[model samples]
Target: MTAPLWGAVPLQADEWRFGLWAPSAADVALRLDGTLHPMTRGPDGAWQVSCPARANLPYMFRVDGTDYPDPASRLQVDGPEGPSLTVDPSQFDWGSHWQGRPFEEAVIFELHIGTFTTEGTFEAATHRLADLAAMGVTVIELMPVSQFSGARGWGYDGVLIRAPQPDYGSPDAMRTFVRTAQELGMAVLLDLVMNHFGPFGNLLPAYVPEMFSDRATPWGAAIDFARPQVQAFFHEAAMGWLHDYRLDGFRFDAVHQIRDGRDQKVMRDLARDLRASAPDRPLHLICEDERNLPSLRENGYDAEWNDDWHNALHVALTGEHQGYYSRFANAPFDHLARAMARGQVDEGQPSPEEPRGAPSAHLPWTAFINSNLTHDQVGNRAHGERLISLVGETPARVIHAALLLMPFVPMLFMGEEEGSTAPFHFFCDPPDDDSCEAVRKGRRAELAGIGYEVDGMLDPCGEAAFDVSRPYPAEDADRAAAWRDLTRRLIDLRMAHIVPLLRSGKIGDGTVSRPTARSFDAAWRFEGGTLRVCLALGTPLGAVEGTPIFTMGDLARDAFALHVEITS
Candidate 1:
């Protein structure tokens, strides 16, 4: 609304000017600490007031007669329903030694702060970055930490796009968490939901009615990215994470819902602007859209999580065909091969359920995040089952071998490396009302879409569901140790040989051949040598007779190729 003075800005040592866009509000007042000062609105419908910027000063916006929280607030100390707090960005002390990490060899670990540790706090997660570094993780992808209504709900339902969730820790704790990760040579990527705001405690519409567009998403009203004001809001929010926290990158959740009905596409513009914001850093931008559109990378985004790979590979290994997986029934290995060699297997064909996607063979191998497990793949199901439980540990490890050794970038869900057996269920703690019922019914319909039943699904609002999802330290210490070692060895092999060969284009077109319906072999010939993997379904695979670089259990064979000089 106002020219370009976004949010609150410091004028002098203690003087700060509070600003907001509430074009629809006739009268506005700024409530700081306890006293309320009437704010003057300009002809353009922007409001402002300058006052003392005290540390941790609590404030709110009183529009007309209704009290509302600042939509641009950096820290929501209390819940989203409570007053906003002043977070002095200058006080956060990140050391001067952060030079940023390149994403060419990125290995991401997707973690939910609320369920990553026993404490579920940023400080608690900070203590574990060293261990992750030892595991050879290059980037730690944090689940959305943005402020949401209740304590937790996978953080996708965040209302405040900039503020960190108070339930996790202080605002400084978020900064410390990123600083610690960078100190360990691992970049921290924050997941953000820019499509729609959460249902409860949303105050933007209360002040500015045009903040939302006529277009609607399944979550709520679609943001009016067509408007210049709305575009500025998101642009500034992305800059906040880049400047305030020095976050290495960002992962946008379900970007398909961001409907920008205009001449200038919002996603492309936002990507261009974010890259301009940090010119010195190799800031990566990732998307989680079902449509593996190549234009997303052409625009400026770094990568996308290839769910096709997960679904195709999951059905192949577990032999479960339901929901979106029914299309991969013909030849599962072919589906896997297309994803490995080509970007996607569907090839612009009309999908079984939705009218989505096109051919992406033109896209490079670096355009997708190849992984066997992720939060959405596991949690969205009727029962939150990780790949390990569905296909058994040995088979899951065989799949993991292909995932980590492949040319594309790879990601791991939290606790997956150690085989913790924890269920990352879709749990929420919304209030008891019609909105809550809508969530239940919506989840039921969503699971039904995927060929799953909701008769025994865990109640999203129940505390027991949230409690059961936490990754307990170790009930089975020895098994955890074995999983950790196996994962470490596989990662070492990828970094030591596979990635180098792929970069130099020495790994030629890979071939996937099935010896029997029970097993398949994927081989790639390199100028130096060859890499072959034999995966047997439901049983231990036969020895390849080359060299065993890494082995899973009593299979007595590794996923690497034969007749090479490599040693493990």
Candidate 2:
């Protein structure tokens, strides 16, 4: 048997060299630019080939005389079944210097490009960069833009890791988006799914067997990260965006689903290597794992999505007690209080819900009060209600403002600034019967226990879902102007004061020293030059005893205006 390193090849300029560990193949040809170039079989059953003539050419492998696509193909013209194209990613001239902002100073805005604008193209989304910059947003957290089956998708189903979706404009258009955002001083954080491939049009299995494990996940069998060559494959994939695409950072999707039993998993080693490769650029690694806090912190990731904070804040403000909200409904204000103060909620004590019990100690966390209104939450719902619909407009606005002012890094979804009434439905395009049926069944199954009929939720693989998720056009200029004003003000406030307070650790233990409430009615008073207070007027319990829980008590006597809202 060949050693694990036998199939390893270094990345070189212009020419692409691939080594395949297919021991049983009689012949393997490297298909480059529509021509088949026969590969040389080396010792240890490794098939090796290099094409110096085929610079910037799209290619795949033909194994055992049968045409098979590259499992790690960077660019594809269409879906997995469509023609693959060679892309020269280095052609784009990047203008911005590779200076990255520290995590503490970053104000992130998470958006799905397809739903961010009506046009749903990279060029179309470019028009909104000024809006993001004006909102004091330093980083734009783009949902996965990789190529997947069909024209429209949430991007989690992506197979071609390097190529952006063709429907969202071309690879050049993607470079334009990144370069434009960079020019506007916004770092791009890409949401990358490394756990499992989508069910439709995944061509990885054609070139490599046992690439996916028998171990199951919510999506499907997890990718085999423990395998020898697989580690190098993922490492290259991670570095490709940084080295080739110039992406600032990555947000790992469902990292908990990556099942690896080895002593040193691929993620840890990749983290070490990534840190080494680009020491100057902030290699921000964020994960969507709910298992435990310490494991993620110790795993070398920079940050993790805080779903607990979302759940707690959603239940507190919206009073929606269905599905997983059951565990978080009775969550005390202390939870939110401590989260803002200490940065983590589940610092100690066994988690009543998780099978793995509780976190041993407090870990730094990013708190999200309104992550529930995201594409996943809204699209997953049977009725697909926006946050404004679930909780009234006033409450939603108050909660949003509160979240923005919190110590942890806050993320806002598209159209959230002015309470966009349209629902962000799950959407896809050019769907077949099986793809459509699977989407329908899967969405329904997800919302089965949410006390709503599942048949109505928009099918992600259907045309209607894509149509429904389109952003409202800028027809109402006045409303759009008002939204810009509000967002700018909030962001300016955060940048001017909130960041400094949090950095100094001035807001200790997040205590509301004034009025307490049973349901929604709440008020708090604070001392010191800068006071932090929380008052909920439209809580379920009823109106608060006193209006405007005065922080900086002398404000009552001054000409300062107090902003009041019912955060029910």
Best by TM-score: 1
lDDT of candidate 1 over 1-568, digit per residue (tens): 3244346666778887887778888888988888898888877677888888776888888888887777878987588877888777887778776878767678899999998887889999999899988988889999998898888678988888888988899888888999889988999898988888888677677777878977778777788887777777787788787788988889988887766675338888878878887888788899988766777888889888888888888888878888667878767766776766675776677655555577676565667888888888888888787888876766676667667766678898888888877777898868667777878888888898877878888877777678778865555999888878877877888888766654554444556665545455666555545556555554444555556555444433433222222322
Clash count of each predicted structure: 2, 2
Over the stretch 1-568, how does candidate 2's per-residue lDDT look in tens digits? Answer: 2222222233465455666656567888877677888888776456777666433456667887676555556666566655556555666888757687767667778888887887888898999898788778888889998778777888988877666777788777877888888888888888988887777777667656667777777767677887756666667777777776677888888777776686446777777777788887776777776664556557677777776667677676667778877766665555555444554566545657554324522443332222535667776667667877777655665566656655557777777766676777777653578767776776677678576676656666666777767656454678667766766777777676655554443322333332334222222222222434343533332222334322211222322112322121
TM-score of each: 0.91, 0.86
Q: How accurate is candidate 1 locally (lDDT)?
A: 0.77
**Which 10 successive residues of model 2 have the least lDDT summed?**
552-561
Q: For model 1, name the residue pairs that clash.
A: 323-450, 532-561
- What's the CA error at residue 306 for candidate 2, in Å? 0.8
lDDT of each: 0.77, 0.65
**Candidate with maximal lDDT:** 1
